[model samples]
Target: MTRMIDIIVPVYGGYEESLRCLQSVVSNPQQTPYRLLIINDASPDPRIHEDLRQFAARHDHVELLENKENLGFVATVNRGMAFSEDNDVVLLNSDTEVANDWLDRLVAAAGRDERIGTLTPFSNNATICSFPRFCQSSAMPDQWDVASLDALFSRVNVGEVVDLPTGVGFCQYIRRVCLRETGLFDVERFGRGYGEENDFCRRAARLGWRNVLCCDVFVFHEGGVSFSHEQAERIAQSQEVLQQLHPDYHALVEKHIQQDPARLQRTRVLLEMLRTSPRKKVLHLTHHLGGGTKKHIRELSVWLTGGMDALVIRPVEGGGAMLSFGATDSAPGLFFSLPQMYPQLLELLRAAGVSRLHFHHTLGLETCLWGLPHDLQLPFDVTLHDYYFINAHPSQTDTKGRYTPDLDAQSSSYPLTVSLEEWQDNQRQLLQKAQRVIAPSAWAVREFQRYYPGLNYLVAWHPDSEKQMPWPAVENPYRGERPLRVLVLGALSPEKGADILESVAVAAHKESAPLEFHLLGYAYRPLADAVIEHGAYSEADLPRHLQELQPDLVWFTAQWPETYSYTLSEMLLAGLPIVAPDIGAFPERVRHRPLTWIEPWDSSPEQWLRWFREIRDFLAQQNRHARPWQDQPVPRGAEGFYRDSYLSEMESAGEKELPAVDDAWLGSLLLQSRQAEGRQGRLSRKERLLMHLLMLRQGRVGRLVSRLVPVNVQRKLKRKLSRKPIHELHRK
Candidate 1:
């Protein structure tokens, strides 16, 4: 016969906590035949009664019992136990949140030994089961998601059961036979609760019933949910009653706790095993845990964790550290000033047993590690997301709408600020210390080589595609006699081709061309009414929006070169025909794909319109010719690419011992960086002095100086001053 278990929860107040407990039980279905019984012990709040009634009506397996008079927790639980006469009983507190397989693990543990009468699981706030200590309540790490923690616990303490003097009352799983032998809780002796479970456990121990703690399972307990206001009085009364009933009860309990010297040591070992068993520990450093970089880090971390232990450390706003376990689990954050908190951060890393480090974007938090690569003793890799190191403006676009390939060219257009130059020099120095420099695309790799040159680097495509394809088939949005639907995705900023879109839409409307433009992202400025704005959409909602507003073709109209186009990769997965500029990674991404047309980077408004019409007509002809959408295999997903690339790089890096940090050399480099920052951008000292003197001169003298010098001469002189070779300056 299948064993049955009845879970009884006694509730007095805290409606929200009670509701969460019920929801967790219902959501996490267990394999064993079980029923949930919630006993309301005359709660003063009418809302609690109504909520319980509603919950009972909604769930057929749930039974709600309301006491007519105020019966304390001990009596309420004893009354609830009568319903479980023929089944095992689990006295679960209303404030506890259970995870999946929690019941199965407990039942399995109980079945391990026939003499085992009661079983308890580890919890964040239970008395003996509380982590890091046997009695004190400590908060669980913030990065602990239920699933991950459950898995970690199972892996760490499988088959490791410990004998406990008493079971924690918050979540006690008692066999029906043991309940029958020991009888219900001693309600007369400990009427209002606090020590009733312990009193009963001591009684059961006299009858040769052993209480065990199943270390493999973890349950979250939000302690002190019921009768919290009367805790001190209840505890004092219960203690006096317990001492009278059993003369040596307190001394025996203390003796049992103090005698177990291995318990704390075993607990620490279990925690360490859960943290670092069967995997290399990797700590990823990034700025913020949001946006594209956030998504990238999350994906990589999750994938890497399958074979390794991965954690992400990012700065919280207002200063502190937050550690994320994989994509879902995050520990509670701590605040500390960057740079000053570097030693503390290092200590945290050491405690976590981090073996390797991966650095992503560190824009706002770079000050924390001004020369981290030189100081850190672990093997590390840096992934370049943009051209921040080579150019002041990360987009590598100058003020005149031109691409600047070299630092000298960039300096001629946009000079660096004091702080910015220091940051760039630091970036260069960090790159020199990296085990490998990873780029998302070959275009990015080429750009990095062109600028930095000769440092080890490799192209590892980001896992940019969504794991599951939200849409099954590409729906043809084209219809006879209506304008062709053209779709553009991304923020409508100037750099993202908002101006180009406006010009194209206006031209299409004026020319009466067979086209209609639909913008599907946030717009800074108002567009013509002819251009339909779909507004901003979250990652989850974007696919649904695309399916709802199916367009004939997707367009990529960025004013500057894209390092890697996440949208373009998504559109390809959707099997939609794309029109993109022949610049940056766009060309390489859509190289051999069918129904893709690439226009020149310098394509004018008229040229863009002409290409759009031609592409639209070409797609129409292809449809007429009966071309299959799935004529070619979809490109390989990026996760596999990244996994292979990363593993290969790690192997190639080998076990070369990193050289010790040369503080003197590092100090010189930092000094040069500070000196560079102090130097005025572009202009020499003489030019700045001359300009100051010219400003002080009267109108005639100033005008004469301005005419004689001219703006062109000043620009030429500034460029000459800024053109000092980077290597020469660094050497000096």
Candidate 2:
């Protein structure tokens, strides 16, 4: 008995392609008997849906199954193959144009071989000379010659056995019997699209079924049969169907591409730091239009050269991670992200003569670090822009009201970093391949080092210049005869201590020298039921809001450990004395920089009121002592601090002694130390001079080596070692 091939073609959008594919199939010259199963994957575009109805309404042998709603490709095919009933189903791509004798040749191949339980008409993905490509219309190269495939791709062979690797999508004629033996495509996987047919073919073989390619009846696949760009959307509508249609294939695809190629690419291409370069390279990974963190390089560049106009960021095209983030609820693994993108970044760097990579991110590093490509692993430097540990849970507020990770089952709808073990695991993996670690605050460096020792931690403190605006040396913006304006900025949260301040607002104002409090940003949105919303301020608008609010002091006010407070740096740069809680990095950055540290009350409202009252008085007196204060120069000049610190931090290895960093990242460690020094500080001239000279090595390695030549090398070593150590700028 001769077997018939029932071809299932999913029709949705691209009506033009569908009609052309239909004409190729039904009009075959081979006169092979077959049924055309057209699955209308209820497309969003009604025009295409209507066209499908009209076309199917006319064909006799063509059976139409219009899905009530779009049920993706696999589902539609499962239904199409069901309607196909009793015949072999060839799941075909509508984008493909068929050959005249495709069905007859496939039917003949199956008729001749009882063991052939699966079959496909071959098509290659790389479209070399398939179509006319402005090739001067010379003697055109012949399209695919089946003889070539037989010679080159003949992989399977045995006595009376014709074996071949899995087929590419064009026309796959699946044996209905094979379904009973191997079962249907796994409905759980959302991994495959182009590779689905190959997966099916392999599974059938594993179940002792054989496949044959009827090359004699070759199809001139106008190509991209099952999945064109638009068809993919239709495919998503029925991932469930595809899961049932093709199982393990989905797993392979997800493992390889993560449903998004960009993620896979970014994870693959992260480069290592250049060991030979003058300056260490770090790959900065930004997930989105990051607000406060992404512009770090731009600010640092300007601060490094003394003027914004002198140093500018020039983006290298098609470099860095293969994956670029849009917006995502969860972390896409490193295998699918930055690790994959290193090669491209390295290529771009090599072309531009860049030697190292600097990696930065506002989100946690674990996602990208965990899934990086093993073969392509590169030495890298990292600057963590934010910590998940900052602030307290919303339902569970700390003193301030920031949303800490909700650890309770009810609060943690999504998985969050739960414990020190998980955090350390991720942190250790992040620093596993790093040449050096760079952070903006002392507290960040210290806290990370607490669990992860043996690694070099470079403290590139955040600069005090972030919030500085161009202006003449002028009078204070908020000083007045009115009650001193006290400003508290940050999102509404316990860690931010906004609620605590609100609790004290009325009491602080009741004193004889009452203080006027102004709370800003998201932190005040809800708790300060009395707060005035500043609308939505982008980073650009934040400074303007500060100027208009005219507060005596801008409080950083974070209750958790901060890596380096961008806001703290901005506050110091503004030349307004700060009043912030001594937690995280805030205490170290603002300790000696003309700022008053205010510890939160242990529990008593009285101690809290006293602290608030004292701060109010201090602001009032500072304003009273205004004329000379306004005219006075900044205590230690602010502008050159970044440049001086950068030069100093990278000047010497003696500055840091972390056992973690070996000789490999000494240069990166120094550079990061200088940058950390630059990130948060008001450096004294004497301290700045010593730091610069220590970190700033003169001339080439050979030249300095020649200069270090001494009459008594041992005495010289002792003398160099005896130099007074530079105290931790603010070690408290």
Candidate 3:
């Protein structure tokens, strides 16, 4: 048969404190099969007995023990212990609160050794087991939450147990074998309170039983609540009685404390370990674990695992999964309503001791930055991948693929259903709520500042840029080349200057220029016959390809202001000459590198040909001698930069309180943006009318209209008709 444990709380006065103790026990019940016995020691207040009776009536495991007359605390606890004949007993004061898993941890530690007689856990004011100091009164720090502290204790001391000369009685657990061997507390000598537990522990220790302190558990004690007025007198009398019973008690305790001055040091070390554990729990909320953003997040997550416990929370097919690094478990339907989700999320965060949250992208996910509750008090930051927050079209380009300088203007070319004003408002709300904002380049920071000024931001390069590349100083890579090979990397879309590549390839082939163009990305359009296509390559495959193909020059032909170019950084690291457009971060990245040429954004095809010719000439001239690449100090890698930024934020998070964000205004803006994105790709009334008219004139009428109208005149009419009011187009 499994032996049950009994927890005996000896109540004196202070009905409110006693009630709180009982309520804490009831709320967080022990996992082990245990019974609670509340002994009312004939308190002056009648309400204390009444409350205990009502509580015991409601709980089957709880029993009320009423004394006909007032019997002090020691006798009351002794009487309650007699009721548990074959079970282990726990002496708990009525003015203390128990945390979850408190009993299980303590009992488990005691059961580890058969000779373990008494076990006690650390408490706020327990004499020997008091945290940070022995026999000193202290309270839990305000910065430490109950749940976080409980988690910290579990993490810091997994199986640590220490031997002590005496056990504090505020909350002590005594083994059944120890009680049977050493007998109960000496209530006759120490009648009132205070030194009974110490006397009992000393007796047990003499009988070859160990009194251990379970450092992994913490219980809150409201010290002296029951005996506040008479504690001094009671303590003095108990000491006198204890000295008479055991003459060498005080000397033995003093010798034990003096022998290990590190006892206090050990306690402090353990507490500090719990307080500053390197295992910072972080939850990364993103869309999917793929693409450039996902790759960046994965690198950052791996780096964080050096001193943190990182987890990724992303939406799966149907629901989502709270996955550790490289774990496979699809938790379906984890997110629901806000009220239902907050508690579940909070519980998970508390259990994991998550202190920081990072949001990357939330395109497909229902819950976004605006949905997060502010009361959680978790410090969070957002990474801006693109201008998605400022505009529905992330590129902020017009219909003809040109950058739009004015943020407030409505574009007729790429008409997203959302207005510029609404987009700006939503962006403002998100930026204001975030504790920090991270961008990849200075251009992105400047762009964001244009909308929301005076906001502090962090510029973190891609983590891949931090890799070390040995300079090819000894060997000239362009030796005996039949023609200077030029490589264009990245997706070959129009935004990446696919047209420019085609024009350059055709122009070079027609003019018989001494340059060979090789394309190493997804070819979106049919390339010119002269250009060689290598198809698409993964990030890992790119280095091998670059080594094998040893292109003399690389072109960064991006049309958009490239936020940050990973390809350009890689080429520069390899000491290869590069020809890139003078836009975005290209000029800033390739600043001091020799054999580099930059073309204007609006440069013509002939101008690109001219730059290529100049680069080829420069490479030929350098091939005469072994041109040692110009050595410059390497920039700080992404891992170090991100780690420093993260640690700085974490260290400062506790010192200052984040200003409260206006959730109502933010929520409205988010709702409006969501509604706009949902309605995207739907045709407007003018588009529908034009489609109908074109379909109606597909036969003889279309032919006659086409013949009668001049081409330029017809194009002017269509352009004028397409530019209509945005609000009117959205009307039902």
Candidate 4:
């Protein structure tokens, strides 16, 4: 039996996109018999009407339909469906372009299983059916045309499909049998667009039919070209109708998002694309601890321009590693269990055609990962963010969190499963394989070479993404009339001088000195009552919080030698008068600035107070106390240099053409992580409510509701419902 499909494209606006869509439809070759049914639903554009007539005259397979008046999208699509005679129907948008055998693949997928009612193809902008990232719009990869992408999908994703709660309508194919049973789209409820296809899919699903994503086909959807102006309003209205008819619609979609059954298929196609492309991809291996190291990788990924892409493999819970393209919500991380799946991980990396390896830190990673460069035979680089290479503890601090200069004594007292020498040997072996050893500061280079001599290192200053602006001159209320206000930034772990901050706060309070202290970040434990903790803050919001506080002096009490500090860079941008210990990068970073003061690293809390008092007295004597702060120049533009440093001409381990290995285990592990059923069960009552609120906020109606609600009230509700942020809840 010959299968036929009627491709119904409802054209209303967007002249150029409509022309291209029809041209592509007519030009593309299809294995199955199909007719192009172009509908001009009372379009205001006369050029489109003439073009449609020309298309109908030029091609016998093409048929044209016209609406005497503006009947909207639901009526237009129903008219086309009514014109079809017992044939499967495809509701393609006017802004979509088709490629080689796209219709053939959709028809093939529909015929594969008898119960499959509707199917949507992979697209660049088709919501749940979108590629590169599901449920998000993705741009076409550089240097690739629509035909090339479609061909790649056809080749790589042959016979691949995933179940979808609802079929996306950008290029949806509906079976003739299923269409008859579910009936045409609800014209009365959804006269224009948006929720019509979802309603049809839901109705079909209730009648024991399945909606699927046809992964092998790729279409280009230039979305929102038709009815772009009224999109938000129409979408909001459509959501209300959907909720009323199918109360479980949101839940079904949310469940699909949680499970993410299409992840493996998407990953496979993406890896294949990257593998074949000429673009250079560098894999960065880092720890789970979110700090400067993670921040560095993220910035580097964003900064690297031209022929370069950065992927990350970071340690996760359960001793596994998650390979992620970038630090973004759309870019999902693929998990692979460590030690047990080390071989699989290696094969996966090679298959992706990773050009080089970059190790940022190894705190929580498996010891076996130390030999990755050697095992994979790939040139690599190692950036020394801390002293993990020299000591088991990255900070190299004593019990009191003070810098322990005596290496021999510290090494002797170090607690480890292996001897200090053995541990250092392992690190030495890893460093030896690196094509380049990177240090962010000159101080870091000097300190690192003290332990690992004769190793060449590259000094690249970390780039600051935050652009600086001059701060308005505000008279420090406490400068001359009251106690001088001091501020400390960042999370103060023991090695970061938490104890010192506590002691200084207590000393200032006990003596009733003309000084006050505030911490923008939390300490390791609760500090003295005198120290005011402002809790934690994100880097993006740091400047706003700092401006609000208007501290007379910014203080850093780090007890260890810092390699490079991102927070220090932020402070530099703020251009506030600074006080820090004379150790690590602080002295070099803050050198030659008149308003900056450096205290001895080993200075006692009382001595630190005296230094603060001296600064207070000096400011009091100054002719002008309040002046507009200017941004201090910081080193930037290392993106190109870093890109060159990481990129290599040497062939990757994958270039040797290793035999294919079954990646089923990796897929299974990834699926297990995404489908962790206990996630919802562990949520508290408040968290459950917060989760539902998050769902509502993410839905179409959410945007409308946000506009209706007062901004401050919405914020308060968010704060109360989300005591713990949504991201943290997801992690749990």
What do the candidate models score in CA lDDT, each in turn? 0.69, 0.48, 0.67, 0.78
Misplaced by over 4 Å in model 4 are: 1-116, 123-130, 133-148, 169-171, 175-177, 186-196, 219-261, 325-330, 407-414, 463-485, 502-516, 550-552, 616-640, 648-730
lDDT of 4 by residue, 1-732 (tens): 767789999999999999999999989888889889999998998888888898899999999998999899999999999896698999999998999888888888888999999999998898777888778996775567789999988887898889999999888999999999999989899988899999999999999999999989999998899888999999999989999999999999999987777777777777777677666778888876667888888777665635566788877544666778655445655666667768767777777777788899887787778777877777788899988777766777765567876554433223455776888788888787677888887788888787777675877766452322232342433447878888999989667887788888899899999988999998755567799889999878987898788787788889998887888777766767777888787876665564777889889888898888888888776655555534533334343355454454645444555445346865775665554423322557677787777677766678567546643355457556654434656765
**Residue-by-residue lDDT tens digits, candidate 1, 1-732:** 658888999988888999998998888888888889999999987899988999999998899998999899989999999975698999999988888888888888888898999998888787766654457676654446555666567666776678877888999999889999999998888878899988888788889999878888888888887778888898898778878877888887687665542253333433354344545666677765355567677677666655555667776433444555444433322233455456655554555455677887665554655455445567788888777666545566544333455545433344555565565577788787788887777788888786578888866667653343232344444544567789999776555777688788889889988888999995544567778898988767877987898788888877677777777767876777678877777886666566667888667789888877776666665542223334333234443455555654342112332233233443343343233333313445654554555345446666556445533355456445543322223333
Candidate 3 residues lying further than 4 Å off, grouped into runs, are 1-278, 315-343, 367-369, 373-375, 400-402, 407-415, 466-476, 479-481, 624-640, 651-732
Error of 1 at 143 (Å): 13
lDDT of 3 by residue, 1-732 (tens): 446989999888888989988888888867788899998888988788777889999999999999988888888988988997899998889988887778888878887898989888777677767654456666663345444555566555655687888888888999888898888777788777888988998888889999887877777788998889989998898888778877888887787654432243233333343235455556677665355666766667555545554556665322323333221221111232333244444543443345677777655454433455364567788887766666655556554445565633454243445677876686677677778788877778888787788665777766655444333432335653578898998776566777778888899999999888998886544566788888889877888998878787788888777777667766766677777877777776665566676778768889888877876776666654444556533333444466665655563223333333233433343343234333443555656675555555566667567545543344445445543222324342
Write out the backbone clash pairs for model 1.
142-330, 142-331, 142-332, 143-329, 143-330, 143-331, 320-335
| Top candidate (TM-score) | 4
Candidate 1 whole-model C-alpha lDDT, 0 to 1: 0.69
lDDT by residue for model 2 (1-732), tens: 555667888876666777888877776655666778888888666676767677777877777778998776666666777774578777777866665455665666666676777665534321211111110111111222333322222221111222344444456777788855666554344333443555566677777777654443334455544355654564564445546655654574444322221211111111111111233222345433344565576455435432211111112111212222111112121121233443433333332223234556523343433333232344456665655322212122221233333344343322234664665475576565666666666656565565567776666554543335221222244444576666776554455565566666656645544555677666522434333445555666767887788777555555455556666655655566566655566665544343345564233445666765666665555543322223222213333445554344231222222123222333333233234333334444555554554444343553355334432342234224432223333221
TM-scores for candidates 1 onward, in order: 0.57, 0.39, 0.49, 0.72
TM-score of 1: 0.57
Deviation from native of the Cα of residue 287 in model 1, angstroms: 2.8
Candidates sorted by TM-score, descending order? 4, 1, 3, 2
Candidate 4: lDDT of 600?
Answer: 91
